[model samples]
Structures are given as structure tokens and as C-alpha cells.
Target: MNKQAPQNSVRLPERMRHLAVDSRGYPVIATINRSPEKVDFGSISERRKLALGTFDWCAVCGMPFADELRWQMVFEEGALPAALSGEAPVHEVCALYAAQVCPFLFSPRSRLSDEGRKGEVRESVVRFVGFESTSAVIPHASELQPGIHTLAFEQRGHADEFSYSSPDELGERFADALAREKPLPVSDAEAVLVRLFNRLDDEGEGDVVTGAALAAGAVFAKDIFKVQGLGAFQGKSYPTAAALLLKGTEEQILKFSHDSQDEAFSAIGPWVLERAGRFPLALQRWRTRGNSMVKNLGPSSPQGPGRSVAKNAPCPCGSKRKARRCHPAGVQATP
Candidate 1:
């Protein structure tokens, strides 16, 4: 009888083991070293060069950084698939922080009564505390670093000293950061940028008018705040992107949302539209200014409004014909 071969696992790359498979069955070839193929995510160029789903990919948050960052699973208590047993999966990073703060988010809180939920003051209070505590601990958090808190929270495990921050805390931090940064209203921002570009242009700065800037300006005009583009018309002038920041019920901004209760929609959507409107306005202004500037130059050779042709007269340039025949296309002969 012939001896049968084992079919199950296969060896992968440098020192890393892998199971090989075929139509019949997968078999292990042998354990091998993990591949020496090193990848870097820091460089955007490198990230672009990478193929999709090449490295550790997260379904929820997308790719996790190779170096220090780790992925953690976060799921609502009841959200776990029936097939899954204990807890919903999450990245390790999220798991660590979730472990520290807002433990309720990980496993569902089943105890709260309907009346308690209706009140739900405790949850809000806890979140507020979390935000204040985090801000107190982390200067950067209090400062409201843009995406830094998220980034830091993601990479906290890598560092020696790091604190857990709740999502609310993160939001507050971001808001504070925005406050500190004091981003000009979207309309004002574009104007500032445009002004900067002009100053740079006057002083022989680098290419200020760029495809990206134009695209960005167009997006600002259409989406966020209505700031006119570098060259735009006045008929198109509209409000600043700040209109999107209007914090009120849809009832308040009647012109904004289709529904009165749609608060989120009312807040940001109009701002985007405002920005979009501005792009055309800016372009129109540019054209108008350009025309005026061009007109400032001296006039060209003067000429009559084609008054030379006389009624009943032969054409001056002789086509050797009567006035009627030669200059039929020209002015009628004088009576």
C-alpha cells in the first residue's frame, strides 16, 4: 500500500508559519521566517503604493499603523452577531481605553429602568466628568488638539505615560482646539487664504493659485461656507460658511433644513452650500477685475462704424461694377 501524505498547514515567509491550501486540501509545508519585506505607513507616498488589505486591516476603523498602534474591538452589548459568543470584537487599543473609561460602552448596561433612562442624567454626568478629568490630566486634551487626541489614544499603549479619554472628552478636546485655532468662518477663511495668495503673488511667492486650492475653494463654496473664489461675481455672493455652524433647531434656520427636527442636517449642510456659492462669486469678481484692468490700457486704432459706404454709389474698391451690383452687401447708395 502507498503511504499517504499529511495535508493541513503550509509554511509562509521569513520565520512566519502559514498553512497552504489547494483544491483538495491545505497542508503545512514547513515553518519559515517572517518576511523581511518591511512596510512604512508614515510616508503618504508609501501608503498609496501599498495594495488594499495588504497589512492588518480593520473593518471598522480601516488600516492600523504597523509601528505602535494597535486595533481594538468596540461593539454595543447586543450588537454582537448571534454566531459570536461572549463580547463583540474590538482592536486592542480601543479595548485598553474602554477598559479604563466608560466600561458600560463595552458590555451593555442592562440594569437601568425606563424611567432612569428617560432621566439618564447619570450617563451625561459621567461623560462630563470624563471630559473634565481628561482635560485636567492632558494639557493637550484641554487645548483641544485637532486629531491629536485620537492619534494619541490610538498609540497610547506605546508610550509609558498615557491617560484614557472618553469620546466626549475627545470631542471637547477637539472643540477646544478648534476654539484655540479659531478657524475663521469658512467664508472669511477663503478670503484670508486668497489675500495671502495675492500678497505672496505680489512679493513673487510660489504658485498660490493651484488646482488643489481651486478645488478646495470650490468645495468650500459648495459645501461648507459661501466664500467667493479668487475671481468671482457679486450676483453670486452669499453668506459665510459659518452659516453651517448655526446651532439651533431647523425651525430657527427656516431656509436650511427640509425638516424642523433634523438638527444635524441643518447645522452643517448649509455651510457647505454657502462655501460652494462663494467659489463662483470669487471667480466672477476676478473676471470683472481683470476686465477693468485690461480696459485701463490705451485704446487701439479708431475707426468709424462702417459709415464710408454711400447710397447709390459704386463701391470705392473697384469691382468694376455699378453701385447696385458691386456693393450689394455694403450700405445702400445715397438717394
Candidate 2:
């Protein structure tokens, strides 16, 4: 008897266009088995898993990974074993899309339909870990698994806890996930500077002396300081409060410019002018004290702004060896 494939009415992502959709319009991933008119979403096809690991194919889109980093979605408890077992890795976009749309992954109320697995609870957080692909054989698994050699990065997000009864709620969750992953546009330097400055302020550092503060300062120097003009800051003196702010800002700009002359340039005039309207009294004391205040601010560190840790010194991560050799050698664990 010839059986017809289920009609796919779902609007799938571009990468998942070639995937076969189940009767419910959910795209069946590459690892799912669909044979003899039966589709088992709860189980993985060992053959397909083997092939995916061997050929470096995405488990969701079944396409070859064009980039060096491969991603895997891991539940809280299964993270360690999943990494060790060499489970199939998917493209980051594919993993993110599946995280939002897959019922068992996205919905707290959706239980596993497989027999004896119906009682499993959904985890509150889903972690996506990216690593370079390294094929290895495991004791429990018969075929080779897509083992991880070095972890590049990891991201965590809230898993949907509410039982969503409508497509609208699901779409909202999908949009939220997409928004979280989107990077800030480079043209919006003001917004980036605001965020970085806010973080620096929260750290309670009057100057960029701490390692954390220096890191943040380096970003501000590279992104915001080098491009903007500072012609409007014509104040002879700034108020005490404004003078303090200017001191820290000027120090960061000068220190960063000294460290990387080609990458960053000192421009305090524009920064002060931009804030002058909002903080009218900030520069009132600057005319009398600005030059002396800047001179007194001093350097952030003995080595300089960006070079907090020496290349030969131990990394802050607590690894015993030198930073340049030890830092790049291991997998970054999931938090």
C-alpha cells in the first residue's frame, strides 16, 4: 500500500526548507526516523546519527557545517554525558529555531510521548554550547559520536514554563529568542557607549584600574572614542561632579590611545559636549580644574590599560600555566 507524505503547512526557516514536516506541520529533524508511514519523533536514528557525526552534518538541517564551530542543545542534567557521547551537533541557527518551536523543548507541559518517558519534566533553562568537531568512539554507543574538542562559547536562555495553548504565544517566544541573539548594529555607537558606560558605573570604579573595568574601557575606546569629534566642549572649568566624570572618561581615552595608537584616539571634547546639555553644571568647574584633574588621574595600571595580565603570567581562570599557552588549550565549561 502506497502512503502519502504529510502535507507541510508550516512556514519553516530557510535552512530547514528541505526538512520533511510531520502531520502536525513540525519539521522532522534529520535524526528522526520516518519509515513505513510511521514517524517517531521521540527516538533517534542511530544510522543517521552516525552519518551526521562522520560527515559533519547538522542534525536538524542535514546540511554540512560550513563553519568551524558546531552547536549542541543540552538539558541541564544531560550536558556532561551529551558532550562526552559525541551526540550529533547542529548549526547554531538550527538549534536556536528548534529550541523555540519544538514542543518538548519549548513547552513545560509537553511530556515525552514515548512509552515510559512521559513523566520526564522540562528543564527551566536550555543551554546551547558551541565547540569544534572532534570525532571519537564511546563505550556505550556502537558508532562514532560527534565529540567536542574545544568549547568556543555557551549561552543560556529561559525555557518557556507556561503551557501555551495558542500559536500566538509560541510565536512570541520565538521572536524573543531571535531578539536576544541579534547583535547590536555597529552604526548605533551611542547605544553601545551608553551600555558600556552604565556597566562601568555599576562596577563602582572611579577610574579604569580594575581588570574588569579595563576590559570595558578597551571596548569603549575602540568603538566610541576613536570616531566621534569633541569640538563643542568649550568649558573653561567643570563642576566638582562633572570634573570627576571627565577625569575618568579622559583617563580611559588617554590610556587606551597610549596602548593602541592605531586603534584608538583620545577625544574628550565631543564626549563632554554630548553630555553638556543634560549635565549643564558638569563642566562649570572644568575650566579651573580640568587640566590638573586629568593630570592627577594617573595611569590605570603599571603595564597599561588593556594589558592587565602578562602573557607569561597565569590566566585569571586559575589554570596553573602561562596565559598564552593555557588559556587557549581547554574547553570552556557551561555556567
Candidate 3:
């Protein structure tokens, strides 16, 4: 389900993702192959503006990320799928046509009411695909950060998608989706997510994004470092890697309903607290500049647990055993 910002929620901020072609932060105007209609100046609209969906895969075609053949730009070299929306990579044709039709490209705005959604406001992501020599965009938002205004898919090759619909045909599909509607079939994972989302609503915590973020925090604090290949991040950007892991795990966790929302929240709550406790200043800075409504969602304040958990204290995960016995080996209480 799409995340919705309430009618009175603070307005989201925005920034333009100007292409910095070289080391000098100068703007470069790159071009995608334009459609005949676009080239002939035959299209005009006074209707509301449109933008791409919030997705990791191609906004036009629903393809999952499996190989480099499918180009999705990511900020950090080792970012997770969940964090790819900041760059929402797509097919070259899709990118070119989308840029032509999207109103966001010419002028970026901080908040737009989702075309047909009554009360939800979302920031736009202006993506530029096909630029080569990939690297992280500087001063960009991390996975946990909100108000991301750009997803740069600079330089890329294409997947062996031997078939594709005509641009006119695909254009209709994109327009429909951009207008708060979908013609695509719902997948099992998404269905399960909706079921769990209903559970969240019943608990008066209806926002899917908030639930997902808190759940992600749980995964980040405990299990991320344990991933077999995560050590690679220690040399470059641990925060980016941690953000990627957290969002990726959140996607996996949200695929089904839990026995209860309390079960759901408790499952992830302790770890969220632990992360805040461990890095108050870093988290605070993320909160200050990174975009989100979840800033005030879970904890009233991100204070440490205030004291060490006794070796005899019950585990934060609510397992019926002492912390030392239940948690992974050498895990210490959050500072």
C-alpha cells in the first residue's frame, strides 16, 4: 500500500537532482531519445502533474532486481533493493519517455497531493538513467532519510528484454499508474503486505511506512552485522550499508501479517531504541535533514535505555531468558 501523509502533516522538503557529469558540481543537460510526439511539440496538458511510482524496480515494467543487466542506480555501491527507489532504475525507453511526459522534470516541488488520493502528499523523485561510471551522489539522502528528490540512474546497459510494448501503449500504463491507479496484478507478497497493513490500521498505527521503518530499525541493530558479506561496508560506508540492510529486511518482514500488532511492534521496537541509543548524534542529524514523517513515530525521544541490561535481565526480544543467554554471543546492551 502507498504511504500517506496526513492532511496536516508538515510539508515535505525538496531538491533538484542536477546531473553533475564530472568532479566539478556543474549541471549537464543530457538527452534521452525523444518520441515523435515529443519531438514534434504535439502534446500539452493543464492537468495535474505526474511522477513515477515509489518502487525499486522499473516504474514502467514490474521487473525484480536480479542481475546487473537490469540497471538500477543506487547511491552507495552496496545499497539494498529497498533503498533503490531513490534511483528507481528503468528500461532506457521507459526512462526517455517518462522524462518527456513527467511534469516534475521541468520544475521540482516539495509536496504534491497524490493525483487522486484525498489526503496523502508525497515528494517527487526525478531520475536520470543511462549515465555511466556509477558512483554515489554527494549530500544525498540515505535509506533511512526522507525527502529524497532525485534517483540518478547514470550510465547503464540494457537487459535482454527481447520484447516490449510500443511507447504509446506503455505510455497509457504509466499514466494510469501515475494517476493513483494500477492495471497490474497484485502479487502474493503485496497481498500479504496489505493484510498486515490492515492489522496496523486496527492498532491505530495505520501508516505502512512508519511500521516498515520501525521494523527495519530492529533488523539493523541486531542482525545486519551478522550478514555474511556485510563486512565489505566497514571499509567504505557503514551507515549507507546499514540503511540498505534495514530497508531490505523491512521489505521481507512486511510480506505477511503477524499474530498481533504488538507482536509486530515489539519484534522491532527494541532494536529501534538500541540504534538511537548507540548513535544519538548521528540519528539526530539523519532526523534533522533526511526526509520522513516517521521522525516522531516510534519513540517519544531517541534516548538510550539509560542503564546496562543486567546479565540476568530478560531479553529485549521478549524471549523468556536472560539477555546473555538469549541474544547472540557477545551482544551487549545499548549505550
For each candidate in turn, the TM-score is 0.16, 0.37, 0.26
Candidate 3 residues 1-335, lDDT tens each?
Answer: 01121212211111112121222221111211112122211111100000111112233332222222334433233223323233334544444344444333322342444343435332333433232222221123334325332222222332222212222334443344345322333345433332333231222222332233223331232232222222222333334322432332343333222323544333333333334433222233343333332222122222122334666677665676776677634333321
lDDT of each: 0.25, 0.40, 0.30
The clash number for model 3 is 7
lDDT by residue (tens digit), candidate 1, 1-335: 00122212211112111222223332111111111132111111111111101112211112222222233232223222212111112233333333333233322331333332443332322211110000000011212223221111111122221222333334343333334332123243333333322221221211222222222222222221121122232223222212222222333333544442333233233433454333322333322333332322222232122445454555554654554566554533311
Using lDDT as the measure, the top candidate is 2
> Where does model 3 exceed 4 Å of error?
1-55, 59-87, 96-100, 103-187, 190-207, 210-214, 217-257, 260-335
RMSD of 1: 23.7
Quote the lDDT for 261 in model 2.
28
Predictions ranked by lDDT, top down? 2, 3, 1
Clashes (candidate 1): 63
* Candidate 2 global Cα RMSD: 22.6
